[model samples]
Target: MDKEKLAYFKEKLLKMRSELIDKLQKKYAEAIDIGKGDGLDSADEAYKIYNRNLMLGRVETDALKLRLVEDALKRIENGTYGICISCEEEIEEKRLEYVPFARYCTECKTELEKKGLIRM
Candidate 1:
């Protein structure tokens, strides 16, 4: 990829990273005091537990995405952005546009998925 394109993806990734961090912080704050001693009845307590779990799950997903974005940024620093990590091939621009943090090209991603290597 050209320097201009790389810069574009870097900018997008940075924005995404910032957004994810903000979301994670908000979710963490919400989850921290959830279900505290509030004299809630059993139904309310169940709802609180459900919401906390949902928030925690979303936090985990966001954290994973943040790590991927950071990794893509590192790849940009190393002059390896837009290349598939598994095959060392240039990933298509369209794929990158859809997923700026993609670490593999479509073929390799499918293969890894079939092998149970890629996380859901």
Candidate 2:
């Protein structure tokens, strides 16, 4: 990709990383607060447990996305952004624009999914 496009993607990825970090901090704070003693009946305790599990799942998802964004930034630094890691092909501009963290081109990604090597 051209320098201009690379810069654009870098900026976008940085912004995303920042936003995810902020979200993670907030989520962590919420989790801590939720862990504090909440005197309640069994029903209320069950509900709180469910909510805590849901929050934890969301935090895990966000953390995974943050790692992917960091990896994408590293790829950009190494001048490999916008290239599919699976097939060593240039990923489509549209795909990069939409995902920015994609490690595979559409075809390679599809093949991996079909073979159960990757999930959506």
Candidate 3:
């Protein structure tokens, strides 16, 4: 990848991480506020369920994003940011534009799916 493009992706990834963290923090604050009130039984139960689900969702999404950010940083360090992991080939520019964190080329990704390494 070109230096400018790599820099752009780096900035984007950092921003995404920051935004995710901010969202999670806000969610935690909301959860705290919800927990502090001894509201109606049904409302309390619903709040608990909602908070659990929200925490789980945020955890999963943030974990994936963190992995992507780490992988991108590794690629930047190893000088292979735009290269596919499975094929050891250059990844499609268009695909990278759509998913800057992709570690495998389309073919390898398809193969991994066939092998049950991935479901999609």
The clash numbers for all candidates, in the given order, read 0, 0, 0
lDDT of 2: 0.90
Candidate 2 residue 65 Cα shift, in angstroms, is: 0.5
lDDT of 2 by residue, 4-118 (tens): 9999999999999999999999997887677665688888878777787788888999999999999999999998989999889999999998999889999999999999997
Model 1 per-residue lDDT at 45:
92
Candidate 2 accuracy as TM-score? 0.94
What would the per-residue lDDT of candidate 3 be over residues 68-105, giving only the tens digit for each residue? 87787779778899898888999897887787777888
lDDT winner between 1 and 2, please give it. 1
Q: Between candidates 1 and 3, which one is better according to TM-score? A: 1
RMSD (Cα, Å) for all candidates, in order, is 1.2, 1.1, 2.7
Candidate 1 C-alpha lDDT tens digits along 38-61: 988899999999999998999899
- Who is ahead in TM-score, 2 or 3? 2
Worst 10 residues of 1 by lDDT: 31-40
For model 1, the stretches where C-alpha displacement exceeds 4 angstroms are none
Of the two candidates 1 and 3, the one with more favorable lDDT, higher being better, is 1
